[model samples]
Target: MEIPQANLGRGINLGNALEAPQEGEWGIVIQEYFFDKIKDVGFKAVRIPIRWSAHTETHFPYTINESFFQRVDDVINQALAGNLNVIINIHHFDELTEDPLQHEDKLYQIWRQITERYSGFPDQLIFELLNEPHEALTSDLWNQFIINLLEIIREANPERSVIIGPVQWNSISGLDSLALPQDQNLIVTFHFYSPFQFTHQGAEWVEGSDSWLGTTWEGTESEMSAITNDLDKAVRWAARNEIPLFMGEFGAYYKADYESRIRWTRFLAREAEKRDISWAYWEFGAGFGIYDIENDEWDMGLLNALIPHVLVFDKDASPQSQSR
Candidate 1:
């Protein structure tokens, strides 16, 4: 099955913003202008990480608040209008990780409502099953959940390309444990943050991140080799399984040195593109963001490194100013 452009393009995640416990709580707001800005910066896709659990009723049927769903709908509509491939997923469902069995039914109920709501959307919209399943959610248990949830999604929208990642925080090695279903309309995904000490250095959210503040990705041969080896494993697995692979997230946190961050970012982007793997960077604006929402501008150095062909955003002018 050929991977559609909607599922196989350079993309960026609208992270922390919507995925936070509360929208805008993380300091980034979803605005209609933001979608246009993303398209203007040459991204072909956008991944919106949404926390549906927070807004939904915690009972049978798991009713998603109409207002919350409408807000997401508006965001999706904006992205579509800008001709961007959009991915929406269940993010930050901490309860599920804490007690998978306890929340299994609720998870199913949420998906039932989501799939039904987006049932009539165009193919440009993709559904990602869940984000970084970890902790109590073992691979075996997650695999079972995936099979069941996919069945529910397929029942509502059989042709929609659904993305599923391995357990253990979507680590590359974790791919070994994922048991993909026999559905061709599926894309396997995994996140890349190898040598985490460098990428996540000083990221307050990670334990002991402060201690790794000085770490840097100098792009040593050994470092490059490790990256290639990790990616090679995923490529081989995807080819063997005859499923397209997507690097759903990858980026160095802001604490890393600018030059080192660029080097790592460019390397990963190029390597993934070399192997024909689709990817979306970790975020738009916040933490691993490439854009600075407060300034309403892109980090041209980062942008240039990730998408070399696109013209750099001219900082001297308005945020919308651009020239090839």
Candidate 2:
């Protein structure tokens, strides 16, 4: 009955690749410089989420070119070499996502190939089944599809950990419908962007976003309490099932004010720690950034105020790591 418990830490998502890595950018994105920043910020882990459909479309769901797989492997090795906990997964590749519940054969084929291919990845290299499965038409449908996906992964990776989330695009509330995988190593994941009114203030893709601009994570005490309470179900489930929980994605979108972003990061870090959950903010650059990739600048003071303390950045090797 042993379960692989993930050591909590702060990390970023390496996105917009497999499609391409901004031509002339050598050696893929797992650069030492990126690791340096993560280390400089005192973060001890890195989560690389890559989208592969464009590159793997050739004989996909059954086969992918070696070049594509090699590219991804190289990036993963870089993070591991830096002594950072590296998590890589098939991101943004869920096909025909218009109706998340379609249960298409292609979807199963995709996982079958992917899980089989990456089945040998080391313990630290966790595999997330899919990323934000857009909103399934209904929770029931979403949950059922995820259940089957879990079976697919378990078939190839019995003990290796895999992460799964619910229909409402990985929202905590949607997590209610998920049933833990039979495998003890499975971790339930949900992205936290609760009370969208605050977190996604200026996010263009969100609905009714007019009044969201200029808004900050500095909502009133009542607001924070309200949002936190909404997560009670997810928290309770993790506690009862003895399955570790991970906030696979959560953060203040880049469009938000810097100060607000810092506050929101602190909020999630604090709440995550309280629940003994591992979390990775939405991204490394663009929108959600611990480091301002474009300007090569980061809100250091904000990092100080919100990071190490609020998040267990170096928990495992950290001088002083906390547990929930």
Candidate 3:
């Protein structure tokens, strides 16, 4: 079977998907009408990042509640109906958030359930192993544990594409340490917040990022070169292993200036094309605002700046790209 590919991370992280409405209070179902707008905005896929463990029976060992699975499935189907591929994964399912290894049995069972539940979903629905494992795990520890997880996933999902990232909260550079399982049905995944000086400038979540305040994303030739060089390294690694490389996440924080953010993304798109890698931006709305919800329209000025670099067609169909 041919492995599936995502056009770009021009996808939404379904954060508002699950909520038990209280006393007539309303919450979005993820499958709501908004996706037509998201899909129309040129997104090729949607990553339904579910935080299900909170609603699950902890004692069941990776056994997810049926209601949650059904809800997730409904959303997944919605994206598919909109002609978009789907990426589903365990996002923050690791309760400890620090030591996933300590819960090996639970982790294995979690993946087993996910693999079985989505076994019938076709190529378009991809599985990301985890959403950025944290807690200062050593390289050896992560490698061995991931290899085992890959073994389990492959047992049930031999042809379904799987994604794996390194232990440093899915840092791109740390990705060098990942050794994919012997199974060929997997892709190495990593997140990009490069020039953290530029991308994560004023993210309230990041401490010591005060320096990036009031600064526009200064995407220089050097920074662009470094990014592509790093991505090229990943591509080469994949080629050696005969697997695909997926830059699963990259987005500038909302603090960056409008035009600068567009410039930065254009550079990212160009660089990804140059390296023969596929990517997904951090999101379609909120924080990244690929779509400005308040206006109910794209930041056209931003999208226009990026149009020349955005990949409207598959790389193979792309015209000869001149160097940046």
How well does model 2 score by local distance difference test?
A: 0.65
Clashes of each: 0, 1, 3
Model 2: colliding residue pairs: 254-287
Q: What is the C-alpha lDDT profile of model 1 across 157-241, one tens digit per residue?
A: 9989999999999888898899987987888899999889999999888999999988888999999999999988988888777
Decoy 3 TM-score against native? 0.83
lDDT of each: 0.88, 0.65, 0.67
Off by over 4 Å in 1: 1-7, 312-324
Give me the candidate number with maximum TM-score: 1
- What is the model-wide C-alpha lDDT for candidate 1? 0.88
- Residues 109-208 of candidate 2 have per-residue lDDT tens digits of 7677777887887777777766776644366665666678778887878887677766677787666666654676777778888767767876777777
Q: Which scores higher on lDDT, 1 or 3?
A: 1
Q: For residues 1-324, could you state the per-residue lDDT of candidate 3 as single tens digits?
A: 122343444555544344222111223345365567666546666776666655556674657778767777777788778877788776765554566556666777877888878788878888887778777465677787788877787787788877778878887667777765676567777788777778888777689787777676667777668877777766666666666667777778878776778778888766775665676666655666465555555555455443444322223655333213
What are the per-model C-alpha RMSD values against the true structure?
Answer: 2.5, 5.6, 6.3
Which residue pairs in candidate 1 have backbone atoms (N, alpha carbon, C) closer than 3 angstroms, thus clashing?
A: none
Stretches of candidate 3 above 4 Å error? 1-12, 15-31, 94-97, 304-324
What TM-score does prediction 2 earn?
0.81
